[model samples]
Target: MLVGDGARLAEAAGDLQELGLGPMGTTQLAYLDPPYNRGGSFNGYDDNMPRHEWLAYIEERLVAARELLAETGTIWVHLDDAEAHRVRCLLDEVFGVEAFIADLTVESNPKGRQLDRFFAGSHDRLMVYARNPDKVVLDGGIAAAVNPADFPHVDSDGVNFRLLPLRNTNKRFNPMTTPTMTYPLYGDPETGAVAVDPGPGKVEILPVFGDLTPAVWRWSRDRAVERVDELVCRTVRGRSGTRIDIYQRDRHEVGRIKKLKTIWLSQEVGSTDTARAELRAAGVDGFRTPKPEALMRRIIELSTVPDDLVVDLFAGSGTTAVAARDLGRRWVVVERNPDTVRDVILPRLGLTGS
Candidate 1:
């Protein structure tokens, strides 16, 4: 639900609860891009509130948001640095620190002027928190990862050849367990210790190890015999003769991408500006900072599977809904500004109002 006015959060929350609608269940995402307390105008509502009252306001929303979440639902609240710390503390209290997934910092201004007194503040924060700690599914692409066919290898035809290492190299080779790996790898196993095949009819066993070498092979003799047909030897042409054939058990490229981080930059998520510009073009102007569509798409992509439901509590310009819809995830937007929701956003989204 995209709400322009912060004051009406209570009413929206009440309506959702009465409807027996949860965030993931109803695609009921509550987006609260309220006034930054900078005296911004939200459909003629005052966004500026005293510090203590603001805290209460947030607490009320948190309580309501928690109730409105399905077993696996999430809520995203966007705010600037002005009150991010306070919001964090409040979120921690409501959702628990464990449920808090990300404290994302998105660039609000790319080419704006710098501040002389201090560093120029160009980014805003979006705090993502799950409703239930144990039940929350934080990963968005769970459905995509479930199907084995999605990781199909290209170019190779033999059962979709995936290049996997025969053994783990993170730790030192186990002297006892990996004794054979200690010695130089011999010829292809199909040809009985031959690394090179003289055409398809003959096998040549190259002396990769010296006579003095004494160690067990990486696999037992029987096991090696069983897997003799699984190896592929790759040979390249020209000056760069890259000769490397790979063996594999699976296609997953482990250790390629690092673990996720908290802060998110704009470049990491492309199309942020295009999304903001789309809102402006639709005449829903004056939204000083709106997250890029790609940025929001990344968040939804990580946390929700296709056909799953995603909720964005701070739905400025409906970026989350647009991204979710594009990614094949279901979404529900809650917004207070009739003009923005009924006029600009609905027409842009092609949703009919009742």
Candidate 2:
């Protein structure tokens, strides 16, 4: 970790460049949680900076950060309401508007700030960007977990799965929008038998709403035909007798990828309260806005995998590095406070007795 106690990123502007990091474009992820321009103070760190200076500082870091990413890599900038909008524009300017990925609203302060000028703010923004748009590779990985109990049904071959609607139920997804997805299939309502083509003792079923509004299938005919074995026909008894409904098996497998949403709020993802508790539990103190390792873990999991290089310029309490290490990733982190490095970070990383 590079030790440089300065006015946040201003006095220590060359910290990242001077570190002699890996090749220019070898890093897979860069997590930046620098001192927010809150126009106030936090502990010994002064967060009050002129608006232009603050933006310039962030712009320098962002420009330098873009150089340290691989084609498949991404960057996440953590900031509160203070500078999110301005930083968003800065990010777009630095990493082209086309590279903008997500604006993850992290529910950090679940209890919402009590005293404010107008309304309470409960979330922090995580501005994400890709070095190369076409090569953006994000995998929610193990962090995107699902309780297997939800998929309780066991298949004949001893696979756990649950039946899901095979039709695209969304109003926008219909014969009017995706005509190619509208097709006919044969099914036996009584026997739960299904086929892509006409079969004896089978009835033709079309994807439609209960009111007979034309709808589309989630899959195309060719894909549905190729994975026909994965589909099932179930008999549904509504107000009007029985009808065959096409279903798809949502199998519970070893590796399941869950799509990360825009707004994050979960115990596992953690919050500002959990972050303070984590520091206290680690026997560390003095960070006014330290992030929980779980939050960092989630971000790292979404962007990278094991052995990938993760860089953190504003390491602070070092939660990002801790999460990266625990997840089996190689990391290069910088902390401006030497005392934090010797006292809190080193001990937290198990590198020092203290």
TM-score leader: 2
Quality of model 1 by C-alpha lDDT: 0.58
Tens-place lDDT digits, model 2, residues 1-354: 333343344444344455645677888998889778776776445688888877888888787788888999999999988889999999889889999989988998888887867878788899999999999888744525677777889988898999888888788888878999999998887777778999998889888765567788998999988988888887777665556789988898777766667888846689888998999999887788899888998888888889999988788888988999999998877666677778877788888632
Q: How close is every model to the real structure, measured as TM-score?
A: 0.63, 0.91
lDDT of 2 at 72: 94
Name model 2 segments beyond 4 Å from true: 1-18, 140-144, 239-242, 352-354
Could you tell me how far off, in angstroms, the CA of residue 135 lies in candidate 2 after the best superposition? 0.8
Q: How close is candidate 2 to the true structure, as a TM-score?
A: 0.91
Compose the digit string of candidate 1's lDDT tens values, residues 142-209: 23224445447754444443554443343434545565454333444443233222445333321121
- Per-candidate Cα lDDT values, in order, are 0.58, 0.81
Provide the clash count, candidate 1: 24
Local error of candidate 1 at 175, Å? 12
Candidate 1: where are CA atoms >4 Å away?
A: 1-8, 11-14, 17-32, 42-45, 112-117, 140-261, 270-273, 281-284, 352-354
Looking at candidate 2, the ten consecutive residues that score lowest on lDDT are 1-10
